[model samples]
Target: MAYSYEPHHFEDFSVGQTFESVGRTVTESDFVLHSAFSGDWTELHTNRHYADEEYFGERVAHGPMTFVLATGFVYRCGFLERTVLAFLGMNYMDIPAPVRTNDTVSLDMEVVGKKELSSREDSGLVTIDTEMTNQENETVFSGDMKFLIKRRD
Candidate 1:
């Protein structure tokens, strides 16, 4: 069984294991807050009228915003809580579809790799293949995330 609400150690992970995160809905306020703090005035994310004439036909959430939100949703799953030592990196991020406002999204996370570090005996590395899909099951974001996780010694 998956540990959705409990902490998971490096030993708890396996190469083929997968987990699904709870869904989160994007909103206009999400865009506004992101813009207010980031000071980005990109029309594709802020101006609906301008975005309506663009390729996606409406405002799309900022690329970074989608990534950040997806990360937060994964964290809310609590599987890594108190067990992660650090975030190593994220690789090959792709926004295949627009993350529109009011779109509900969830993360499908698969453990791509896991290995103990000889030099750092207290921790190990975990690599995750992630796909963030919207309400219609369209992959809106995709990436591989790596992190340092504590060993169960």
Candidate 2:
């Protein structure tokens, strides 16, 4: 039987709360698939030999692709379900280090703040800071995302 989890309501979220998602690894196929789907043919992403000669010493995973995968991990771990209404936008998105193929990555989220929209009684905005780290424990990317969430009341 497929287990059904009751989604968290906005009221359940509080400042200082932290959530973590399962880890995932970047694979060559993932890189290829993402590159193909997005039409991003930058040498650093699609040309391994060229990348090895110019920079990264080898083909590197696309930055946006890495972010997408990390976001999927978060969703799989149940961070965005009934509690989340709409994804607003991202802030301070930074890809400080290149994610390489086979690099294991995970997501960490911290609830930085929350506010009840005066105009909406049933929903509010929650701002959280998210960080993606590699197996070697280096932060490859970081950002803040705001989501509209339903209030429990």
| Winning candidate number (lDDT) | 1
52-147 per-residue lDDT for model 2 (tens digits): 897679988888897787677656766568678888888779988989999999888888989889998989998888899999999998988888
Worst 10 residues of 2 by lDDT: 1-10
Per-model C-alpha RMSD: 1.6, 3.2
Tens-digit lDDT track of model 1 for 1-153? 453767889888999988888788999999999999889879999998999999999999988898888788778889899999898888678999989999999999999999878889898999999999999999999998898999888
Instruction: Estimate the overall C-alpha local distance difference test score of candidate 2.
Output: 0.82
In model 2, which residue pairs have backbone atoms overlapping below 3 Å? Answer: none
Native-to-model Cα distance after best TM-score fit, residue 79 in candidate 1, in Å: 0.7
**Which candidate has the top score in TM-score?**
1
Instruction: Give me candidate 2's TM-score against the actual structure.
Output: 0.90
The lDDT values for all models are 0.89, 0.82
- Which residue pairs clash within candidate 1? none
